[model samples]
Target: MHQLIASPHNGAFLVARPGARAGMRIPRALYEQVASIAESGAPLPPWLLEGARTAWDLDLAGLTMRDTVLVRPETGLGYGRATYEINKGCNFNCEHCYLAERRFEGLPWVGKARLLRLLRDAGVLWLQFTGGEPLIDRDFMDAYTFAHRSGMLIEILTNGSRLHRPEVIALLRELPPYKVTVSLYGATPDSFDSLTRRKGAFKLVERGLAAAREAGLPLELALIFTRHNAHEVDAMRAVADRYGAARTEYGTISPTYSGTPEPLAAQAPGFLDKTGVFQGCPAGHTFFHVDPHGLATMCKVGRENPVDLMAEGLDGLLRLPGIADAQMLRTGGCGGCQLSGTCRVCRPLAKAYQEAKAPLNTYCRHGNEEA
Candidate 1:
């Protein structure tokens, strides 16, 4: 396997090691030089030799470009990042899950391979594989290996249920991911199992975490706070500390992607922090999301005009910027609100709250002040 990946990212060139967070950005001329060296099997350049050692502790003293560097061909398409939902199936039945229905379905292996290629053609360098639990998917290893070999830095968003499995751990150990983000429900079995509605869920996840840590896998723990386990916030952080992994906390909850109100009931009281001002995001312009069936959208929340990648191919993505712009517009219920200038919720999110008939205080500034 190549030790490093050299690719064009959003019009700039970057050299990153597999399973590493840090990378070195190189100029276009240097990228071209590296590509030529790799193609001709030239010796490692002195600059790269020293830079790789300094950045990632990687030594290229005896390796040629062909053995150490994988030069990804440049695609003029501007996109640099994407999230692909491998499958929506999950073993856990968490009440706070944003999916109204956790359906166990997705495209077959052939379609998945094609979609990854299309993403590569569109210049996607940072790819995240998410799901109800991506590790449980039947073809996840195949798809992950394919994408990794294609020069995309991969991240897996998982529930950590399968991290204890020998086969899963072995695969990940062999082909490391940039990051494996596991969601932590609670600190203890009672809270964790109760929240997930699974009798042995906590034990499984605990085992998974231990196994991942032992293997030195790049791991991040997402500590999720819900009414069911809000009291265990400190304990959950302790769990992350014990594992020696990076961590993040999530307190706010949202309605289901399809506008179902069920999940909002799990929101922990006093945990909802006021959202920040709505600065425009580069959703469709620089990054996009893909559902199981190869349907591409601007982001996870704004699923309005989707591009069917399977049917329309990469050219279909041409319509996404317009679709993203349309979805972000302050139309419908938000058409003429006086607070639009300072509104924290974007139009698509506000629309979901409206569809769910959510209490105004949950999402609206006016409702917050009234409360």
Candidate 2:
């Protein structure tokens, strides 16, 4: 019998017969949704499934992974990726905002019960704190505290606006993998202010970055690639070099958001480089997101195959348009390429680019080219 067994704590499902793994197949609807919108109505082309199988590392003919290991964290991209919109609204507003309607909305939070259940059911080992700026959320501690309690690794993407706050400092002091990824627009205020369109951001970000490093938090100085800062790559690296153990990664911005999509460059089609395999992109399968509006999506962009989390629990979300069957969908740009699981191709920027493009054209995509 085929029954979908899911956990409230680890967001995954096991579909199998009594004891066999060879006959299992993830539902077909998953493929239909993620199969290029151009191919949505057509039969899935052969390359798609071949690529998906290759990316998922499934032995189509032999079933290399045992049925019992289907939901094991070690066996798959279990609890793959999650973007927690701690602070749903933004203040800097350079451009391309889907949440423009929420510009002045208060920083709401995910309930403690809901969050713990998400962590436990999704097996969400990797949690990303995002939003208007994760730092600005009143429940930043509440979210961080839950991640810590769940014993998951975490990374935070921020505009670097509030690192100086005492409570923000306290969370970093106690969290694990307390990675602070800052989107530095330029080396100085003149150019930086132009990108974020906010005054005094340059000084605040610099000081915030320093405070994070001094506290010994793992720091990744992220440079938002754009025509404006294209020439300042060296200066950006110089900033990274100062931090002995900190990293400096570079990436291009995507102009996919419907409003003011292009911050400093035009949109790139495919959003992905179309050159590598993410080795795995088991997003909706492992981890997923529930936006402020209570929509549950695989990633942050919230456009593709979005399942309203409020209407449906985790199990129902997986059955939505884009994720019905877990195994049949392609991991998009990184599904069948050589990089496989080592690339960060399914990031928020990538998602935005795919959904529209502005966020990607103006964000970072470097670090761990492999998974």
How badly does each model clash, as a count of residue pairs?
Answer: 0, 38
User: Which segments of candidate 2 are over 4 A away from where they belong?
Assistant: 1-80, 96-113, 257-260, 264-280, 320-371
Residue-wise C-alpha lDDT for candidate 1, range 202-285, written one tens digit per residue:
999989999999999999999999988889989999999999899988887889877889989888988775667787889989
lDDT by candidate, in order shown: 0.89, 0.53
Worst ten in a row by lDDT for model 1: 362-371
The digit string of per-residue lDDT tens for model 2 on 127-218 reads 67777677766566777776655544567888877876667877777554546777777777877777777888888887787777787777
Off by over 4 Å in 1: 365-371
Residue 13 lDDT (model 2): 27
Error of 2 at 323 (Å): 3.0
TM-score of each: 0.96, 0.61
